[model samples]
Target: MTWLLLAGAIVSEVTATLCLRTASRPGAHKGWRVLVGAGYAAAFAFLSLALDAGMPLGVAYGIWAACGVALTAVASRVLFGEPLTRVMALGIGLIAAGVLLIELGAAH
Candidate 1:
């Protein structure tokens, strides 16, 4: 349950970030702002729920941030034609590895 909540938080945060980018474009629909705000709100709500469910703060936050970043970058590349270079992919890999290390350390 805690993991599910954290996953929700990550997805919400990534969606909000993408919405923010869309809202920033010229002639973009104003309604995208509403979605951006709502997504962020939902993300925080889910994160709080995960915390309340006994997930450690450090582990939860690390995974949430890492996954959000990775997913957002890939989504941006696909949806917005954003440049996702090899170096950026390597960075994403490093972020995932770091999060994995954090989770492993938390287990000990």
Candidate 2:
């Protein structure tokens, strides 16, 4: 249950970030701003639920941040034609590895 909530938080956060990018674009519709705000609110709420369910703060946040960043970058490239440079991909890979280390450390 805690993991599920954390996953929800990650998805919400990534969606909010993408909506923010859309909202920042020239001639973007005002509705995107509303979506951005609501998505962030939902993300926080889900994160809080995960924390309440006894997930360690460091582990939860690490996973949420890493996955959110990686997913958002890929989504941006696919949806907005943004560039995914090799350097950026490498950074994302590092983030994933760090998160994995955090999770493994938390197990012991």
Candidate 3:
């Protein structure tokens, strides 16, 4: 249940970030802003629920931020033709590794 809440937080955060990108574009529909706001709100709500469900803050936030970054990068590349260069991929990988270390460290 905690993992599911964390997953919701991650997905909401990523979607919000993507919507933010779209909202920044010239002549973009204003509705995107609404989605951006809602997504972020949902993300926080889910994150709080996860914490309430007994996930440690360090572990939950680490995983949420890492997954959000990775998924946002990939989704932006696919949806907007943005560059996902090798360096960026490596950076994401490093972030994932760092998050893994954080989770492991929190377990002990």
Candidate 4:
């Protein structure tokens, strides 16, 4: 199903992003370096497949970015004790709204 492909896209994107974080830290192990490279490659490969399946680029991109931002923010706050200010919440809300708008636009 298309939804499954989209889910794959989300997973790969998140993996890639998390990998980048792991890779960026100084002195990461070789395993982490391999993971990061594989993650990035898989992310692009999955996303490209999603695009090839007739999804609009804008819609796919919007969904991917929105999901990434929302999930990553919550995860970082929980895992890293990162701050979550009202301004950040507002920004995320706006991002959600924009994603909704993109979805609605696609239906017309």
Candidate 5:
């Protein structure tokens, strides 16, 4: 259940951030603004549950940020026609590498 909550939090966090970005554009979507706020509220609530479930904060946050970066780039490209430039790809790769190192180092 905690894992589920954690995943939900991550998804909602990402959704909120994306929606916020969209909402900032001209002719903002009021619906998305509402979603952004709701999603963030849900995210924090679930994250609290996740912490209560004994998942390490470091691991949870690392996973959340890495997924957010990778998924958002992919989502923007596929869903919103945003360009996935080589630089963006490289930055994501670095984020992945850094997260991998963090996880690996924490295992000791």
Candidate 6:
């Protein structure tokens, strides 16, 4: 299903972003760099598949970007001890709401 493909795209994107953060750290292993590259490639490939499956560009991208941002922030907080400020959390919530609106509108 297209939704499944979209979910894969989102997860791959978030993983890729986290890998990028790890790759940027001091004394990071070279393997993280390879992971980042491969993750991004897989993310794009999955996203392309979702789009090809008749999902509208705006709806697909909005959901992908919003979910990626939210999930990445949470993952960073848990895995890398990054801060998750109230303002950032609120912004992520807003992104989710906006994506919901986009999806709802697309259904009509």
lDDT per residue (tens digit) for residues 29-104 in model 1: 9999999999999999999999999999999999999999999999999999999999999999999899989989
lDDT of 4 by residue, 16-104 (tens): 67766767778977687788778767767777788888888888888987988877777667766888889988988998899899989
- Candidate 4 Cα errors over 4 Å, as ranges: none
TM per candidate: 0.97, 0.94, 0.94, 0.86, 0.81, 0.95
5-103: candidate 6 lDDT, tens digit per residue: 999999998998999998998999999999999988998999999999999999999899899999999999999999999999999989889998999
Cα deviation of 102 in candidate 6 (Å)? Answer: 0.4
Candidate 3 lDDT over residue span 1-108, tens digit each: 999999999999999999999999999999999999999999999999999999999899889988898999999899999999999999998998998899889889
Encode model 5's per-residue lDDT on 1-108: one tens digit a residue: 866987898899888988988899999869989999999999888888888898789977887778777888888888789899999999899988987987787678
Those runs of model 6 whose alpha carbons end farther than 4 Å from true positions after fitting are none
Model 2, runs deviating above 4 Å: none
Global fold similarity of model 1 (TM-score): 0.97
Candidate 5 C-alpha error for residue 98, in Å: 2.3
Give the per-residue Cα lDDT of candidate 6 at 84: 100
Ten contiguous residues with the weakest lDDT in model 4: 1-10
Residue 74 of model 2 has an lDDT of: 93
Model 4: lDDT of residue 67: 85
Choose 1 or 4, whichever is better by lDDT: 1
> What CA root-mean-square deviation does each model show from the true structure?
0.7, 1.0, 1.0, 1.6, 1.9, 0.9
The lDDT of model 4 is: 0.78
Worst 10 residues of 2 by lDDT: 60-69
Clash number for each model: 0, 0, 0, 0, 0, 0
